[model samples]
Target: MEYASNASDGTQIAYTVVGSGPPLLMVHGSFLTHTIWRTFGYVKALRGSRQLILIDSRGHGRSDKPHTPDAYAMTNIVGDLTAVLDAVGVSAVDYLGYSFGARAGLALTAATPDRVRSLAVGGGSHGAQAGAFDRLFFPGCADVLEQSGMEGFLEAWSSHRMFPIDSGTRAVFSANDAQAMAAYIRASDADSGLPDEVLQHFTQPSLFYVGSEDRIRLGDTRTAAALVPDSELHIIRGFDHATTMAASEEVLAHLERFWDN
Candidate 1:
């Protein structure tokens, strides 16, 4: 594990660099750290062929947590990532992000097309309406933070049907700082807009993967994919939003082929 200081914004982001080939950066979803990828053995699986750069976004995992809402802005997040890349001496690299992280990756690609070699966005959508189902599954998420802090928020989140919080993963979740994560979620929800005009011009090679049963953004993912010239969408069967990451072998295979080509 390594720590990089985003001097541009005075934030410290922690990331782990593993593996040994082309530069491949991985970003985890909201409320989870890079450890989710490690726990699932993804780091070891890709380490042989790629240098896995795993990051814990600001306010998540070991990264510095800022309390103010403005601290978690999209520009700040993008700046933090830019600083990490600069600090790591990586001029350009491939990016893989899940959910909130995926959205951040898209923003990064949009901001600096030349810096991203390729992009793979998993289990994410392009806009606010795309996350409408959160009202049904986690109606209290919006209130928990202001009402009782991140711990209260996580308690409500773990009870959701979408998140299968078993003993092991639960422990991982417990280790996370709930207050920081709540700030991140608030920032994400605040800036959940992706304009079609901006995305249509994104010419980088890209892959969009979503679960077949993901009611929230299933249609939006297809729409976003259609706008990107060299992008392809892969829908994983028998998986919902949370399980899609685990059941995405086909998506990973596609990425391997895309990287090789």
Candidate 2:
């Protein structure tokens, strides 16, 4: 485990550098940390041929958490990512993002196309207009935030039928700082929307994966895949938003092929 500071935004982001080869940065989803990648064997699988860089998004895991909405803006988040890469002396690298992390990756590519060699986005979409199932799943999130704090949010998150956290994962979830978790939730809420022009311009080599059972952003993902000329889309069967990360063997395989190409 190694720590990197992004002083440009006054945010100190923590990241782990594992593996050896071409640089590959991993950004995690909301309400979770880079630890999820370790728990799911993503790091181990890619460690041999890729320099896996795992990051704890602001307000999650070991990264600095800011309470104000301005601190978590999309521009700031992308800047934080760039700062991490700069601190590590990486000029360009492949990026892999899941859900919230995926959205961030897209934002980064749009803002700084030259810095991203390739992109792999999972469990993500192109816009904020969620589907019916998503509305139901996320119904009254503000209330949930007020009552449950971060732990309650994670408990409810784990309870969802889509992804169930195992005992070992559950232990890690329990140990997270509540304030940081809440800040992440707020950051996500503040930076939820994706622009159509940016999506259309994301022409870099890209791989997009989503669970067939994911109703929230299916349409958006389809639209994004079609817009990017060099992008490929893979829809996994028997999976939903949460389980997509755990059972992502095919996703990793797609990345291997994409990077090799």
TM-score of each: 0.91, 0.87
**Candidate 1 RMSD to the correct structure:** 2.3
How well does model 1 score by local distance difference test?
A: 0.78
lDDT of 2 by residue, 1-261 (tens): 566666666788898788899899899987688878877889888899989888988877788877665777778888889988987789999999998888889889988999999999987765653332226346545345557865675567666647676777567666666555545555555555767777777768899988898776566678888888778999988787767898768878887888888
Error of 1 at 100 (Å): 1.0
Instruction: Kindly provide the TM-score of model 1 when superposed on the true structure, using C-alpha atoms.
Output: 0.91
Where is model 2 poorest over a 10-residue stretch in terms of lDDT? 128-137
Give the residue spans of candidate 1 off by over 4 A.
Answer: 129-137, 158-164
lDDT of all predictions: 0.78, 0.77
- Model 2 accuracy (lDDT, Cα): 0.77
Candidate number of the best lDDT: 1
Tens digits of per-residue lDDT, candidate 1, 1-261, equal 678887767899998788888999898887678887877667767999998888988988888988776788888888888888887889998999988778889889988888899999987766764234255348746457667765665677678756465776567666766566556556666776779888899988899988899876577788888888879888888776767778645667878887788
